[model samples]
Target: MEAPPLERKLAAILAADVEGYSRLMNGDEEQTLATLTSHRTIVDALIENAHGQIFGTAGDSVLAEFPSIVHAFNSAVAIQQAMWRANQELPEDRRMNFRIGINVGDVLVKNGDIFGDGVNIAARLEGLADVGGICVSRGVRDHLRDRVDATFEDLGEHSIKNIARPLRVFRVIFDPEGDPAIDLAASPVESPETSSFVEQSLSQDRDSDDEGHRVELAFWESVQEGDDPAEYLLYLERFPNGQFVELANARLESGGTGEHDPGIELAFWETVREAGNSEMLEAYLAKYPQGQFSDLANIMLGELRGS
Candidate 1:
């Protein structure tokens, strides 16, 4: 008989770990352990209340699965808030902060345990988060975009270890009191001129006469789902002012790769300067092979790598 095929399902995974665990332990192992134990209780309760299942835990880390991505996001916010409250009265040396990351993707299920990039990405995202902060993959943000009233600041695309594609990430901004936070940076109303980007899309022929529009739509959809930087270049090459040009440029997030809006190019340079993400540097060099910042980016990348 052939072996059974492993089951797979689409779900959201939330990964979290205490920051500076080793340093905290070095200071006082007993207090650190006790505090972690106490914090887990609060985290567990909030997660359960949000309809989440805790599947894995090790030392100061937690891995949970949620059928609903929104619930995953909510529980992450709640857990962080609870942790913040727990630390308020403690001495600075005794306080503990946890970093969280959430992602929605397909995963393999076996004997009550889940495995795959879905879980892997969540774990890696945790590493990128600041202490006591939450980072979410693009998929999770998209699912919660309209349904949840919260601010998600784009951190740009990242080249995660072992992941096939560079994943786009976002940082969540939530109120500790649990009130939904509005994205103040967003304009409530859009003028017709500003909405032009939405009006133009994969229909590249400048006319979208009929058959040409359909073909472009298919390619655009593929590019969106594929998350392939090269495909984004192709999309832009075909339609410079395409509807998704900005989005495609964002996904590309580099200096030169291909022609792009001058405004977006400046933004990329500024973000590269601010974040100093090595992946961003690499992407910059790769996309904008002949970009103005190519030499500077190369120098910085070399310094980062000690090359």
Candidate 2:
């Protein structure tokens, strides 16, 4: 028998699954089912509002498609923010956090269901995401460049299970107050209040920059102690002929700073920013108590922990 011709098209797939669904269900199936039902209603409504179609679903999971990658990205952010708000009303133990992943690629459609590496990648990406977090493939990330207002932390590349090539993955930094795409019909006119705010923000940036230039801070501040040879090494690695090079070299030659393996602070910062859970902040603080961005890290830790 000859099989029917396959129907395929480009698509943006969003795959989401409840984090720790098995544990939640095992603890109380009835309650979990009840809460999931209510959540599904909210989720489906939001997806539809964003022009996304629910193509498939399994227990504690959802599969949706959006024609536009930007909208998909927006919807994913909105869903996580919505879920966070919804979870707040429930007891902490019963709250359900969903991990969402999005990807854009060619897809095969049959009987209203979608199947392809695109869908598969989305699912795998979902697994890579933190509970209540979102992950997107490089395709989606590239599409998001200017279409949406969001921040993504590059988590580097990964070799997917059963996939021949490695994939670049990025984690969307969760924003409590999610930003949705503006309506196409909305006027491009900038209102007085918005214009004022924008102007003020720019003014502040200019002022901050002036202050920053006087100090030439951040990276230099970390190595200022000049007590760690690795720190000097790091500075040298970053700036071979910097003003501090002479000092760094002199310090090194003088049987310099203790070899305390001055950590790769940039990479660590990236990991902290890509944190899937609040615990990463704690780990970061413990390791880099006096490191750069500790203040920001503390603030972020508090936000994630208290949220």
Q: Name the best candidate (by TM-score).
A: 2
Among residues 3 or more apart in sequence or in different chains, the pairs in candidate 1 whose N, CA or C atoms overlap within 3 Å are: 200-243, 256-288, 257-287, 257-288
**Residue-wise C-alpha lDDT for candidate 2, range 51-158, written one tens digit per residue:** 788988788889999888977887788778767766766789999889999999999988678898999999999999998899999888888877666778899999
| Deviation in Å, model 2, residue 161 alpha carbon | 1.3
* RMSD to native, candidate 2: 21.2
- Predicted candidate 1 versus true structure: per-residue lDDT over 22-123, tens digit per residue: 999999986677667657755765676677889898899999999899888988987887677667657799888999999999989887788999999999
**Global lDDT of each candidate:** 0.74, 0.72
RMSD vs true structure, all candidates: 23.0, 21.2
State residue 162's C-alpha deviation in candidate 2, in Å: 1.8
Clashes of 1: 4
lDDT of 2 at 176: 54
Quality of model 2 by C-alpha lDDT = 0.72
Regions more than 4 Å wrong, model 1: 1-5, 177-307
**How accurate locally is residue 145 in candidate 1, as Cα lDDT from 0 to 100?**
88
